[model samples]
Target chain A: MNNALADKALWDLRPGEAATVTGFGDALSVSYQGRVMEFGFQPGTRVQCLLNPGFGAPRVYGISNSVFSLDKEIAAAVFVTTRPPQEASS
Target chain B: MRRVLLLGSPNSGKSSLFNRLTGLSQRVANYPGITVDVASGPMVNLPDTELVDFPGTYSLEPISGEEAIAVSFLNEALADDHVSHVLCVADATRLEKCLHFILQVIRECQHHQKPVTILANMSDVIRDNQLQFDPAGLAAALGVPVISVSAKESQGFEPLVECPAEGAAPATPPSRNWRETPNEILRGTAQQLAAQFSPKGDVLINSQLRLDRFFLSTALGGLAFFFIMFLFFQSIFTWSAPVMDAVEALVSGLGEAVVPLIPNRVIADFVADALFGGVGAFLVFVPQIFVLTLVIGIMEDSGYLARAALICHRPLRVFGLTGKSFIPLLSGVACAIPAIYAARSVDSPRQRMMTYLAIPLMPCSARLPVYALLIATFISNDTILFGLVGWQGLALFFIYFFGMLVALLVTGLVSKASKNKHSEQPFVLELPPYRLPTAKPLLRNAWNRCRQFVTQAGKIILAVTMVVWVLGYFPNGGADLGESWLGTLGQFVEPVFAPLGLDWRYGIAILTSFLAREVFVGTLGTIFGIEGSEENMLPLVDHIQASGLPLGSGIALLVFFAVALQCVSTVVILAREGSTRLALSMLLSYLVGAYLLSLIAFQIVSLLF
Candidate 1:
């Protein structure tokens, strides 16, 4: 239960699993599932891991980095929690 | 002024984001029919900036029926002067799928010289997953400033929000030769791409994402349809309730205040009956109508209405029309005029006529008052049996179910003889990438519809009410309303339905409802001669329950309204779409169906209950 997978892991990392973040911020490539655009989530976003990350184009097409984008003005209403506090991060 | 677009694939959480950004700053349409307003919302920009939330789509390449709109929009904009700043929002988890669209948009926008940026939204989600993002690598490759942010968390706003748009352009590819058939080009490309990338072998074996699959597409389409429809119906009831009551009170007070000013008994009654019961009644229902139109406007602007037409196609086709014909049927539930015009999307002439003919069978809002009133009086609060079938408030649901079923039955019957039969146009739509839904487009759509409904239905209902009033007015000047020509006309018809257990009041309500279903309850309210209205519908029904009319007659009235073509506007749609003969047949068929169903239902229920 501990390598301590996070909520972002649920989007990019698998349940009861973990992955390392090598870099801080390079606008994560926004894309889709089959054709998903996983850019709806803001910076310091959480994503889950699909397959062991080595499957098909994982970086380009994984549910690991999930986010929803609304119409331009509508996107502003969203309030993302800044990277969860170390104690509160699950 | 500044401009930007929010774009991403379906269910990528784009719509939820839009709701949060603009809360009630939107207006439903103030105009109708001719031009559709898509980009019409204001966002508070830092000092000064403009935001445009484009429709959602899978890729610039068209995929599903609804998604096709984005492709066409992009293509059309390429030809026209229309252009805006682009924010290509990609999901952190599904970057590959999202990149294709981003690449396509970049390639196109760069070619058009439109300013654009890339947003890797849902950074919080990526952070939660312990995901790493290389902005330098992506920025170098796509040639657009990449900023990762979350629409839900609103993170990464400092750098990306209100940031200056990069003037550097993207590299473009050669255009295709259109003189050659589109199919010929598709065939050639399919053969070419087959050689470079392995369409098979290990790549195919490890493929987790199926770009060429139907399951994913259909699931997205269905989910969008369900979510949008669920929100629409819920909003209609919740948003409109308070406003509707306020409207009712305004007109009711006016009617009472004006009543004492008139001198003669007949004139005093006429002012209350004709004005309050006519125009006043119509105004009372406006709030519900406005709310329904606003929800519909949002669905239309977001480009989901086309998806609904696509999803509801199969079920509607069972009634003899294709997916293209489904909107008219759904709109028929709202009101019929728009439903008929909506039938224009159906290419098959016979299908259009059949849809127009059958739309009247569906109960509209006008009929709701009639059904509610009738159900209250005859159906009893308690359950009754109908020849092994249990009838309760459940009978109410069947009334609608029966209308939909009859539409199918009629369409099926008509389709058999149609020489115009054709295969369904496979619903290949471009699911517009999710974007913030704005208020301007929603408002414009609502207001336009309001003007259309008011001008169209208003005049017809008013003219008819006046004519009806005149008919009951002169000669002896209706010494007693019961003695008027209209009253005598109603009482004369009462005996014909006596077998179903109705009296003269029931006859009057039915006759008046033909003008518009809103009048049915009003006619009854006036007939009972009640002073001051009850917010509750039950008290009136309680009185009817005590009246001599049998339970069977009450139930019969409901069933008839449920299945009958009571709304005249629906008949107008039929005539306008096809011919006088066609409209007449639609009317005849519904009247006959109504009589037969209610007769059988009443007879069976009377014996059993």
Candidate 2:
């Protein structure tokens, strides 16, 4: 419920930036939320943006040791808090 | 027989492990959802025990058709009395991402009172990447026996095979509290276990990211994809031409030597015309099928297919399809039977139906011989562009492109016409780490595909050829084809194809092709051989050219074949996968559409030239 953290979505992070998932946006339907969670997007899990192929294509993200390509709309529905740039080195 | 179920998330090496234990090659690949059905075989060492491999699933909550198959099968297998143990496979390198599924499987086993063991696959990958993982520690935490096994290197099988023979105990009694944990808490528990015992670094992800930087880049990725596709289409013609010619020569030589050995005139004519002329023509195209399957198998095993799907999402979405549809559509190029099976991975029902509509239009290999004969007869085979390209190969490429364009157009029009306003499921796909493709399994798979193509299509083509030969041979003893029964029947349907400038001979080939598309080539071969030719040994293409068929008619035939749903097997599979009504409607509509378009093509060509 923190104002600054709630303002950011996973889609806002650029390449090399890491973030901790807070929760899903209200825009996502309940069933869709469950589907996303089953794909390892639960709250408190760390996710890093790896690549954003330009021209409005899906961007690549690394969660744990696995990589998944998610389109823009789905990426925008997951809320996250970006880590400090220096602390995101790993 | 005692049954042990093998279950895991997609691309987790479950199929590979099954192959290793049971010694049955079940088509393992790096792409997800390749194993769309359940397969079982007796274990190699323990013949009394059966190993069952289910299609991969993310969780018991099904999202796609294939996953639904896996979940429903699990429920049935668990309730059955013959089932004894469950071996849950997890990717050792991606333990944290895999643990949630493993926990769900464990909980399900507890509910059914079945014993479960965890087999952590890809331990060799962890070692090669210079990472650490403690299988013993993970086993203690989950209170289930965990063994690290590498299906790639055949490592750690000694312990894996022994667990089942000892009658594995129901995952320890002391962890009853852990077994009863709710689903919400199980997610956190999976993370905790992975953090404590799994490999701890970004080395694997970093390596995969380096490759994705080039393969998933905006400009470079598009250029690379087009280049690879061009090579793929070009090689289908260039690589297989020599083998095709060798097959043609061998069949004809054997016919010439053996046909004269039979002194009776009737039997000699049958062997020469039916066996050598009809079935032999279809055999020449088998090498092309093998080459096509090999290249597609290479792409699937190297993990480039997923990257290609990502690159295609934007363009495909415009046609009411998702990136996942790219796999099935491309598979359609080889054959429609497996391509229809591949559509189970698409999550949305509407999008999957759209994909089914588009799949039959993709230029499958069965149509390759028909197009090749037409092109060879009409277009000169001379090389152009400073000898860098062949005219015939370029024609093949353009024909393939035209078929794909029509598919996209039809799907786009359907999308615009439908009144449904519901939102589609999101596009989320996993990109497995790129690996160098091994040559052995790929060659074996391609060989198996060739054998399958021959056996499945061979029976139909042979029967149709025999019927055509017998009907054309009688009534005048091969003296006048016009007096034959097939000739009279063909003339009956000749009016249907007359607008395209085709005669009764072409009419008969088109009619019989409904049994199978490649039969078109074989039928033509049989007809031309019977119609009083001293040089009947000439290849079908030469015979076609010598007949002086108009260029307009040849081009019209190409267009007709591109649009028609001629294969009965494709229609049957479509009916089973979709609905009987949907399949029949598609069959009728495409037949009408093909005739109209070909009429237009014939008119346009005649006017311009």
Candidate 3:
């Protein structure tokens, strides 16, 4: 864990690196096996980029947050996330 | 309903993406304390999935209005249970700068563990680029399936609609944190991007500019604004004249045709003086007003207007306002009604109120007739220059110049009077590539705005004109109006204006304008007792000139109209928006402004001419 943190601090934020999760939440907690693939279009999935759709647009939910119907259709798609830059493993 | 949230960086075609996603379903409003509009709409992507587009921003920790709305909307939706999916839209042309917003959203989603999709808009722009960045490679790096599409051409839409998008995880889906992965290293992103894709491409996605760009943008914006304004005003006359003339002819024809049909002289005269003379004359100006609104709408839609606000930032900041005040002020030049409503975009309540307080100082369309009449009548064709340029040209120029100046002065004075805190802000503008205003939306808007003006004139201008006509029409003991009590009333008031060098007929015209300035023409037309012709308009000018009304009076009248709080509709708007106190203050301030400016203008012109 300490090595991962040091490496995380050392290596430039790149496409592929392995480190233990810290500050876990429903936002980026997608089920993954090979470098974390996403199961998108599910009801309980929480999205960070879409919280409040302004005016009349639909709102997206982060996991644990209830799903909103901006429209009626429901399908899950995949998105990938990486550790935030400048943070180190402990 | 399934929700689709659109995200992007400033000027990265976010708004255009929204326009594409939402089309005519778009509506604009503000998140609290933000000047940028947070617009949303549903996309019929899948059978039941909805699309919700958010405001464009630089980072999630939104500072300005656009960013605030973006950040706030996301944060708010995360706390709520409504939204299903998030779509991170990035501009392919400026892909790197857009990454910060994407990364920030990623962080937030990590914090919440929600899966989001990235829609790389302007894919068409990238498709045509000399340097191509691998979308699949970038998508692999982020771990989310990245969909490349151009909204304009509807490319990649079927894939987008057919592709899976869901907020909740499927049963037994990978829910591990992103940090456990090997690709999660965080160093050298920009340098790698530069080495890998930038030279052949242009990547500095996460960057800002020196202050000089803002100033340059402002200067260019000001020049462009004036040039566009000139075109706008030119179009108002050139395009709307035919329609205005036709309406005038039709109304006059109706009044004349009805005169012989209706036997009673009073009824016939009332029909002529009140309905046709008053309403018809005011409605004649509607074409010009409608054409002006269309130009404004086009300017706004094409996105050059945002640059004007950005360029106007420092000047606007001087008045304790945001650049947001610029559009409202411009809107006031057309009419204060929508202009005041436009004030809702201001983040600070104080700034919004200040805008409302000051917008009326900008001369509106109601004052246009007064200005046109004065300029056409009193301005000489002769060119007198200070060195080599014409003084009259300078004078005509100063008419618009002074109106804006008076607005600034009012803003300053009102800012001083109010105890509101004003923080200085820089203008963040997105200059959308200019496009021709399309026919359907443009014409629909023009017609809607034009219809309102005609209707209002039908209601108010006609009523007031009729009242003024009746007051001037039937003299005491049924004596001749131009010769009896009405003439006597006009004469009594005539001397009061003599100080400014106007005759009683001018006095009568001014009195009629208490209803509306446009009514001044119809009032004079009726009081001159001329019928079925615009021919007498020239004679009325002749009579004013022939009456020995000094150049000073003409100048004074113009100045007063320029500064005066003569617009009743504006007053009503102020009262409704703020309070009676604000309304009264507006009235008092304009009255003072008009008197002082007129006094100065009349004195100067009297000495010169």
Query: Highest DockQ among the candidates is held by which one?
Result: 2
Q: Each candidate's lDDT (Cα)?
A: 0.55, 0.79, 0.56
- The TM-score of candidate 2 is 0.83
Best by lDDT: 2
Off-target runs (Cα >4 Å) in candidate 1 are A1-90, B1-227, B253-272, B324-354, B380-391, B417-420, B423-430, B476-479, B528-543, B572-584, B606-609
Candidate that scores best on TM-score? 2
List pairs with backbone clashes in candidate 2: none
State the local distance difference test value for candidate 1. Answer: 0.55
What TM-score results for chain B in every one of the models?
A: 0.60, 0.81, 0.66
For model 1 chain B, the run of ten residues with the poorest summed lDDT: B197-206
TM-score of chain A of each: 0.24, 0.82, 0.18
Candidate 3 on B138-240: residue-level lDDT in tens? 6666666567778666676565554435554222222334533222322124223322432242222111112113322334534656887678656655677
DockQ of 2: 0.65
lDDT string, candidate 2, A1-90, tens digits? 232454488888899988877778776767666666766777767889999988778889888788888887788998887765233322
Model 3: DockQ against the native? 0.02
Off by over 4 Å in 3: A1-90, B1-10, B22-84, B100-116, B130-145, B159-200, B203-232, B243-368, B371-401, B412-422, B427-508, B511-515, B531-536, B542-554, B568-587, B599-609
